[model samples]
Target: MAHASSTHDPNVYFVPHSSKWPFFGSIALFVMMIGVASWLNEASWGKPVFFVGVALTLAVLFMWFGDVIRESVRGNYNRQVDVSFRMGMVWFIFSEVMFFAAFFGALFYARQFALPWLAGEGDGAATHSLLWQGFSSGWPNNGPAAVGGAFQTIPAWGLPLLNTLILLTSGSTVTAAHHALKAGHRKQLLLWLGITVLLGCVFLFFQAEEYIHAYRELNLTLGSGIYGSTFFMLTGFHGLHVTLGTIMLAIIWLRCLKGHFDRDNHFAFEAVAWYWHFVDVVWLALFLFVYVL
Candidate 1:
């Protein structure tokens, strides 16, 4: 064999073997899904199974993430690894966009086609008149008057507007943190990250309060009507994404505290930033479709 190079190559991305992480992750997800489905059906042991699955999944995630962190700290990942991670994140965000698009498509279809037809428009005008006689056309609001449960529409004022501002500010804060990182201002980066996380928490708290206000005061609930269902499915999922993005940002901040990244090689932080911005965009869509319209 030819003589090997004496010096180690800094540009190579070296990753050790991880034997069972993928298998364990699959099992964890399987258990979780079984538990969720069973629990939804009121099975007796579903909750326990579900909680166990959750615990298992969390443990696996911690261990897996720990390994990655160790590898990162060891400087084993090169720019190639970072590029792969960037591509993965891009695809993941794209999938999420498509998911939200499906829901939005449903909303659009209902509004443009189904609702109009039900209101005696086009060919449906004659059929609607005979089938649902004396039924006046109006947007369904679940309350004393509507067909669904006793509920009402959530107004687009006050807390919602405040939440909009909060999320907008959060987006800015995250961007600022990214800029600080690029500038190699470590202290400023950490501070901005912390502020971004705080804003995320504040947004979550306010959203919880808003949900309570909607349920107790406005009588808006998931089971109210098509409107309520779509509203919850959109905003609720967006909120969940926000929570996840916040956790990711918090983790990145913790990594930064440990001096994990630099100006030229900070892909982890960039990935989280992309996710946060994705959450922001989804929320803007929700605000327009669910609140403004």
Candidate 2:
């Protein structure tokens, strides 16, 4: 219940005293992990436990962010704090880039090396002889053992393409909103940000439909060999990022309505914009590598 101290000097960097949110968040995450493990093993109580953990985690985030927003609005943040925030966001985005890079690397290695080796191409003759015989080495191979049975891939020209366009348009809308904010046009800013949020929701809807088609019609699933696994892993995580970005945009929209940001002091808006743009770029990569090529 302690509030940020109001007696701090403006020239110095402000730091809040120890907060319990991090500890609570960590505990929630641990509980969620336990629930996930239990659910995977078909424990009867896992679903409820997982839901409880998720609710607890979200509550913690809500309270924690509310505190931060209160602090920002109270002018507790200065130039040094702003610089630190910028640096933190930059490094966070960099880490996210590396995370996706790892996934892409796995895809590349599986396609260029693992699949070909399993099929006895080049120097893999001995490996093939000792292991999977008569296995085909093709793009989208179901592995030598046929781990998840045969399945058809969703075409690049279908819902995936539509979602791509939606994300691109949303990117434009968000950029326009940023420009509007900078120009002190609150009406235009709200309009464009709302459009961006709508586009994000549309993209997510299409993605869900595409997932349904993959599962029911195409027989594609998480267990559908390397192709299916990698496809879902990349797209699913990206979808989750889009969901988070959209939520952030929505929150910003509400803040804008309350006259929370001024022309020159809106790093919160900029940070969310940066994140949304990053999500767009990652989706572009996913479209090219996972769907097109």
Candidate 3:
């Protein structure tokens, strides 16, 4: 769509005409998913296909978001459109909540029910003798058979604590940035937002270091059984979110530099801030349950 179809009639509810990005984006994602599945199954051509799909999807997203940025900047978006975007983001975040909930639920089930049942604690009197003879129910056990030998859990008070603090600081910085935007303090907005992005980057860096420590020094990995799997899955997905949020913050920072928002009509900034806060909250839950617990 080149421009909004509705001229000046606010009642018209402007809509883009026959957008192709959605179709292309869907195809790109399908390809990416196929590649990932193939790679996981150890296909010979899987790595190249996965990389190609990743590149294609990223390109589609870049172009698609660029179009969206252009459309928003062209004043094509009305207040109604802004409302739609807000509603969409709300549901999007809700879906993300469900996604993380499933993982956390799995962790809870493993620790509370599955482990105990297998270890003959509750109702399985003869199961432990039939299965793992001397298996003891524990929080961070590597299943009954001890898959991938023994592994050490990361210390909660070390990098995890530091990362928690970094994310908490980032949460405050992003909020301050949001307030700066609403108060029309562009300079302050940029400053706080920049710091938030920096903090996010630092968090990811520390997480990488933590992962390395887990793998090389502690003998922990995704194959170290249930504990290893959950640890990486929870922290890995959270890190991916932080990376995406950081990128969005950087883009929003640029938009701020270019004066893309006003005191009242800055739903874009608000949306990212909302997402960042959601990430912050998720990290807090992860740190508590996945680490300290």
Q: What is the C-alpha lDDT of each candidate?
A: 0.79, 0.89, 0.88
With candidate 2 superimposed using the best TM-score fit, by how many Å does residue 187's alpha carbon deviate from the native?
0.6
Candidate 1 per-residue C-alpha lDDT over 62-141 given as tens digits, one digit per residue, 9 for 90 to 100: 78878877777666666566666779889999999999999999788767777667667787878677775554455543
Candidate 2, residues 1-293: lDDT per residue as tens digits? 11223466657987887999999999999888888778867899988888889889889988998988898888788777888888999999999999999999999999999999888998899989998888988888778888789899999998989899999999999999999998999999999999999999999999999999999998998889899889999999899899989998999999999888877878889999999999999999999999998
Give the lowest summed-lDDT range of ten residues in model 3: 1-10
Q: Per-residue alpha-carbon lDDT of model 3 for 147-189, expressed as tens digits?
A: 9889999989999999999999999999999899889898999
Top candidate on lDDT is 2
TM-score of every model? 0.87, 0.94, 0.94
- TM-score (C-alpha) between model 1 and the true structure: 0.87
Alpha-carbon deviation at 146 in model 1, angstroms: 4.2
**lDDT agreement of model 3 with the native:** 0.88
